[model samples]
Target: MHFQFDDRLNSFRQEVRDFVAANLPAHIVNRQRHKSFAPDDLHTAEWQAILHKNGWSVPGWPLEYGGTGWSPLQQFVFNDECAAADAPVFPWGPRDMVGPIIYTFGSDYLKETFLPMIREGRHYWCQGFSEPGSGSDLASLRTTAVRQGDSYIVNGQKIWTSGAAVAKWGFFLVKTDTSGKPQQGISFLIIDMSTPGISVRPIQQMDGDDHLCEVFLDNVAVPVEHLVGEEGKGWTYAKDLLDHERTGSSYIFWNKRELAKAREIASSETIDGIAVIDSEPFRSRLARIEAQLTALEWSVLRMLADEQTPWHPSALASCLKVRGAQLQQSITDLQMQAMGRKSLRFIAPQQMADFPVSTLWPDYLVGKTSVALITRAATIYGGTLQIQRTIIAKMAFGV
Candidate 1:
């Protein structure tokens, strides 16, 4: 498939770049570039609101549903340019996950209620899938929504729910039938955060950030209309949502930005008073990573261009996610190695207040150790490295 952008797409990309450079808050970019972190809710809402105002937030959704109707290549270009510009990554719950699901399966009323708010940055969403014992194997989830007349009383727990603490709504999968087969008994439901028995408790990661959390639903009543797709067919809808998640998880834009950062550090750092970029071993590793990233980017483009009846193999998603996650870890490790002892020293959050302090490394490096520690779990979350390999074996290799 053609990965190169045509003239029109390039123009669109330049437009996006100009917009972000002109409008994205400097503080948000500082948090991303200097702190090596994702934006907080406040920053996310600020940037998202701006993008929504310009109709740039929903490029992948259909135009009727507030999308820009950019072609596949334009979409690719837009994302690449935005990431390269160090734009704050917008909240995904609204644009990436639930928006597409709603457009596809929602009733007109549901679409009217949610799509406008999603487009306007007025609502935030979280995915409620993982439970204590049911993360990877979602079919084993114990969360249940028992139908009682016009509403369903949900009672269960979800763990590792990213952004749940700050989310205003969530799309969840709950067991609605006990007698049917495990996968066949599920149903999808959307719950408002203000619902009576819902509570969110944050889970602090090794990075000292509270991005993930545990959500408890105790007799949380969701109206029957909130169901997506069909009753007892939630498993189907869940699979579709997950497929979307995996397809987008290729991490093309973010990895491209990160690879550029790695290259920048290599170009700047010296080893034994000699430039690290001149070292054969270091150059070889960087070269290999770039090549892999290039291949991964094209693979993503191919999938996007040919999104038709012959579904892209699920194993490819597993492969890209595994490699992308590992490459991120590898790049971070190489940066630390280059920094040497300088990376060992810690930078407390208090020091961040003193911006642009003359440090050997960037402020984000203050928490380099913390970031690296957290990235160690990259191969584990979303699904583990071993699980991805299993998928490759069973699906790709026809084991």
Candidate 2:
């Protein structure tokens, strides 16, 4: 909760900063500066390998399973430092979302087989939670998996599956029983993406990227051993997973880093013979956003500390989720506004090196427009604003 760090924490932060500076690849830093969603598979694997070598791959996990074994404050400091250095975080599904589930509730076989692969970055994983009809109402999903001899026949479609096209595995929510309530009948399974009858259709975006996909499983055989925990217990496990995810969703570190970049871009670019940041109206907006972001960052520190706070963790997490997503959208809008007409003109990857070399826009503006458009959905993913409102109404207000 303190604004300034103590000696030990400050040293740890410096260590993380030095690691990022010395080890993070140049290509990854460039892609992140331009707001590319993530580094490509090769770069990510290389980065993860370096983290694994140093026992920094999964900071949130138990130490035995390749976690950093850092205190909560250390974890927060690490993320803050990484984002400050423009370093990419490890992929979520393998490191944050599912790895904990396996270590906490999975069989010995599951942990031995998958945790090592995830630690080594040998496979990419995706979530199969949402469907065409089921958006935030994931409990009402219609995808079904029938248990057979040694495997389960999975048949259904999942939309908005991030990284599904390239992910080698997926953790899915499926209707494994129909006689009971919808939430009670659900099960979680890790499906091999290479299985027969499994198909991925990339969802092209305005950003000239295909990070999302529609995954169809038509009678795809998933081994029963891949099921996590127990039958019909996935809803419970999913609740745990979502809690981990939404807690991380505050994204204060990311917002803080990106806000600093926005400040840089505004001060560097000029409009009508004046620096964009010199405008009073723009400063007013930036000032307000900066204040709110500072408050959000403090709230994150408070939650991470796990000390007694006036607000409950669940309610505070929902609050963070709401503000963080909104702040992301605001920052991107500011970036697009700072660039003005230059944001409108775009160039291909190859042309990026030479195009607009002598302009105020600079190369960073190349992907700013696409990032702005895509971030409009920031409030919708993970959990929508409506869902967070529902959670806060229940937990914070007890209405």
The candidate that wins on lDDT is: 2
Clashes of each: 0, 0
> Model 1 residue 232 lDDT?
87
**157-207, model 1: which lDDT tens digit per residue?**
999888898889899989999887899889988899889899999897766
On a 0 to 1 TM-score scale, where does candidate 1 land against the true structure? 0.92
In candidate 1, list every pair of residues with a backbone clash: none
Q: Model 2 — which ten-residue stretch has the worst lDDT?
A: 348-357
Query: Candidate 1: where are CA atoms >4 Å away?
Result: 1-3, 36-39, 307-312, 348-356, 359-361, 364-367
Model 2 ranges off by over 4 Å: 347-361
Q: Estimate each model's TM-score.
A: 0.92, 0.95
Per-residue error for 228 in candidate 2, Å, reads 0.6
In model 1, what is the error at residue 235, expressed in angstroms?
1.3
Task: State candidate 2's TM-score.
Answer: 0.95
